[model samples]
Target: MSAEKKPAPKVEPLRKTRPCPECGKPSQREHYPFCSNRCRELDLSRWLSGSYAIPVAGDEAMADGEDEN
Candidate 1:
């Protein structure tokens, strides 16, 4: 019996990556859109520290008034 050697399987990227939020490096599969753990942690830190936030379109005073009604 002859032994056949198979070619290595190709690994396609799971997602199209943009630059890392903390660094300019391309993303890795493990860390994803960030290049490394440090970048990921930095992003988390920013979020936890309130450096990142979502903007709401309504006034808080109006929302509070509506809630009472």
Candidate 2:
């Protein structure tokens, strides 16, 4: 009896190539949305340091506090 090995199946990417958020370079598979480790780290640092934040509207801010009236 002879044994044969099967070839691996080809995999497809879910999405098309996109620019890195940090430096506007083509994103890499290793670093995903970022092109390289440096870009990835820079984005991480921004997140960790509170540099990226969602702005709140005046109404939302007032709702969080008691009404002065």
Candidate 3:
């Protein structure tokens, strides 16, 4: 009897490649969104150091701790 070999199945990626936010370079699968470990760490450092912040509108009532009943 002769033995037959089967072809391997095709695989697809979960994410598409895009430019890295830190360096604008093509991102790698291992690093994801970032081109390298250095870029990733730099972004994290900025976040932890409060370099990035979310802006909020100045509401007088909230600032004075007054609740609207």
Candidate 4:
């Protein structure tokens, strides 16, 4: 009897990883920018608690509740 060998399956390489923004640890696929759920939640909490803010630029007089002519 002759033995037949099957072809090997293709192996997919893991995607590149970056350091977590919260803890500086290796990030995971599930958590993405964060390493774990805790880190992800912490980041979200910061956003929700107004720890992070975006700067805006406009007229200083208008911002000071003044009228312009």
Name the candidate that leads on lDDT.
Answer: 3
Which digits, one per residue and each the tens of the lDDT, describe model 3 over residues 1-69? 998988978775767889999999999888898999999999999999999998778887897999988
Candidate 4 wrong stretches, greater than 4 Å:
1-15, 60-67
lDDT of each: 0.86, 0.88, 0.90, 0.90
Residues 1-69, candidate 2: write the lDDT tens digits: 998989989886766679999889999888888899999999999999999999876787477886768
User: Where does candidate 1 stray beyond 4 Å?
Assistant: 1-13, 56-58, 67-69
Please give each candidate's TM-score: 0.63, 0.65, 0.68, 0.64
Number of clashing pairs per prediction, in order: 0, 0, 0, 0
Task: Report residue 32 deviation for candidate 4 (angstroms).
Answer: 0.4
Worst 10 residues of 1 by lDDT: 60-69
Q: Tell me which residue pairs clash in candidate 1.
A: none
Q: What order do candidates take by TM-score, descending? A: 3, 2, 4, 1
Best by TM-score: 3
The collision pairs in model 2 are none
